[model samples]
Target chain A: MKLDLYKEHAAEYKAVKKPIFVNAAPAQYLAVDGQGEPGGECFEQCVGALYAMAFTIKMTLKAKGQDYAVSKLEALWYPPDGGADFETAPKSEWRWKLMIRTPDFVGKQDLREAVKALQRRGKNANAGQVTLEKLHEGECVQMLHVGPYEQLCETITAMLAFAEANQRRQHGLHHEVYLSDPRRVPPERLKTLLRQPVRKA
Target chain B: MRDRTRHSYEQRILRVLTHIQQHLDGPLELDALAGLACFSPYHFHRVFTGMIGEGLMEHVRRLRLERAAQRLKQSRRAIADIALEAGYGSHEAFTRAFRERFGAAPSAFRRRHAPLPVPDGRAVHYTPDQVIRFSPKRSSRSMSVAIRTIRPQRVAFVRHVGPYDAVGEAWERLMARAAPMGLLGESCQFIGVCYDDPEITPPERIRYDACIAVSGPIRPRRDLGVQVIAGGDYAVTTHFGPYQRLGRTYARLCGPWAARSGRELRAAPSFEVYLNSPEGTEPGDLLTDIYLPLMPAPGTE
Candidate 1:
């Protein structure tokens, strides 16, 4: 049977309309780092390279009779200057790490081979930009926002207030776990898990 | 043709392993191991984890314990001295760790002359003077794939356009800016956005972002910029273990999984959401969620 990460860690993926706290477990990822607005030329190119490498890896493993369902697209976002509030920062100064989660068994050799494959194909010039990353957000306050992107501000405010009332303070980057396909689903019906790692104030 | 790169890495790792066996009492810093293996310190830990099926420190600690076990069977030295040599501060701590690994206390094991413990597929165990032999593990983990719709998010970020290993300064700068502004909250997520390939792009030209999700409209500053991540459907996978070993997972997804899923690629940047931080977590226990944008099916267009 194929591995489904979402189903395996249902708690992490599951969220509600109201903000709630949960202790997240550890996981791994295929990551690429970049600086710029998310939909710009550089961001587009980076995403393209990232997928190219991801497919190369998938295909190689399939040949060896190992198959898995490729998971979701998640990102960690932050601003350069600490003095600049994350919510208020300009897009030009934004830095982000775009990622795809991979299984635990993937090793460095697999990465080397995939990189070599991409280089040999000479198709994705940015494939080498892909790297592995791991995160273990312990405690977080998360809420599901089922509306357009512009409406997230209100949800975030409520979520932050909820966290504040719970005696927790934001301690890490703001995290989003997208559960809907914006390409297929209308913005009004988009499903996003707005999560924030927190600590006791 | 078979890749020569694998062999080169194996050789480098083997050299380190042999050195570890010989220098059981010496300080084995991560930088020193990376130097010995000719790998960047930033990426070396993962590389070691991938090739060795264990983290560097973990491997070292195991070796030291195994060697101590050998000495217990053969030597008459004080258990305290042996424990000290094994890097434990006290005999009690050594005894606990030893009992956990060998299934008996050191003194009991010495009296019993127990048989060698079963190999955990690594096939490498400590031997006094013999060269360490290694057998690369062939285990591959299965992954689950899901097509998700990501909502556009506004994030504040700092740019680090260089080698992945050198991106620490960017994170430090970002945190330095974030902590003072009360942006360091319980709900914030740390993220990195990669824009270029290290092998193809000049190290100085590679683009990376250190980012945090922000709520409410905030003014953009000279150093920190905010932007919305475009919302779209994406293929995602969750990876468990150290970040360095993600290459294998990427290969699997991009290769067989993509081909089999019958999904076309979307022309957008992929990103990672760190579900947890690394400072307090073990390397093996860290979790990262990876995202890749996907094109809508042909009929939907």
Candidate 2:
């Protein structure tokens, strides 16, 4: 059986429940950087383009004797203006990068091939913007936000307070690992793993 | 005492401590311990208490309870099982005893712990390793903190408890055995993995491992265990002063760097890499690198 890294090592994939402190192992990902307001059709298209290329590579590798489950959608958000009020940032000014965890067998060459293959099918996948990369998140404060996307500001504030109490502050881009599919789940019931990378402040 | 007599005494006590730590879940009767110490059963209690600063039974109970509390915080072990593991015969007995020591029920303590202090903090005499640094205006801006990836390492280590100042002894013992194996050199890395926050956990109960990274075939003697230190991205800050003021450097990291960095702490244990030993080096010249584990922020991938 193909090993499920998340299930076998539960701590590495610790769910956002409370403000849990964690250190993450380095993992590979298929990433696409973008600039826009999320929850709009454009962002959804970007997510679709990412998944389309991701699944193409997944299937391509499956045929080569490496079968694995696709990871949940994850995104990094930040303001290009270096502003503190990211919650109320204008949609046009918000910068983001959408990603999915990719296996080691899937490399930069494979990502390029996946993008080309999607184009060959007459679909304009945002394959040009996607890249395969490795990310190492050392220690973090994580929690599950299970409500409307708009309510995330309050939860994030609480998380920031928790980090401040423990002597941590924001360091990298704001990360949200989407655990629930917004299409199937109601906005009020959406579940997202909200994480803020921090350093000793 | 003569050198031979002192050595024997140290060896025998170490043997007893090794046996107790290795088999914490097993019976540690006073008679059996006295036999191991090669002391008369009648006089063992007094001798052990005098030497170790606690009664044998009291020491065993404390160790077991402390181990149980550790498991409760980090693992999903059953309370009844943990109670048994702590050497209590019944749940009620364990509850009463735990409450008496920790000032909370076992479950409550697990949820929001205020750990009980170890009975004796004076295991080894030491010049202090850490002290609160004041007057940040001078040193705060001087610390240069950086984030980078660290590769995984395989190392052999010996655990130590008591004050951070006493951790020097654990390093002493590890090097004693490791040096003969030709494990000390420029190629090898020294790391100290401290698992507890001194501000929270008692100084006497704080856990630390003095480790040396090694590869290839290496024999691990009793009390020396081998494990891998998981390496990844870390926020590293170097302290260029006496070891006592290192906490002030950490405050510089935690208060300024961590609070404003947009990064969060990872679950992995942060560690220190002693760039230079105290020997032949002035206190003002010693360099120690403190590595704090980190992760990306919530809204990032």
Task: List DockQ, one per candidate, in order.
Answer: 0.02, 0.01
**What is the fnat of candidate 1?**
0.00
Task: Kindly list the per-residue Cα lDDT of model 1 for residues A1-201, writing each as its tens digit.
Answer: 767777788888768899888887888888888988867877877777666566556646654667666666777877468788656888778888888888888777877777775555344567788898888989999899999977888998998899889899989888877676564457898988888999999
Using all chains and alpha carbons, the TM-scores for the candidates as numbered come to 0.40, 0.39
> Candidate 2, which CAPRI tier?
incorrect
List native contact recovery per candidate, as a fraction of 1. 0.00, 0.00
Q: How well is candidate 1 docked (DockQ)?
A: 0.02
| lDDT for each candidate structure | 0.73, 0.70
For candidate 1, what is the total of clashing residue pairs? 110
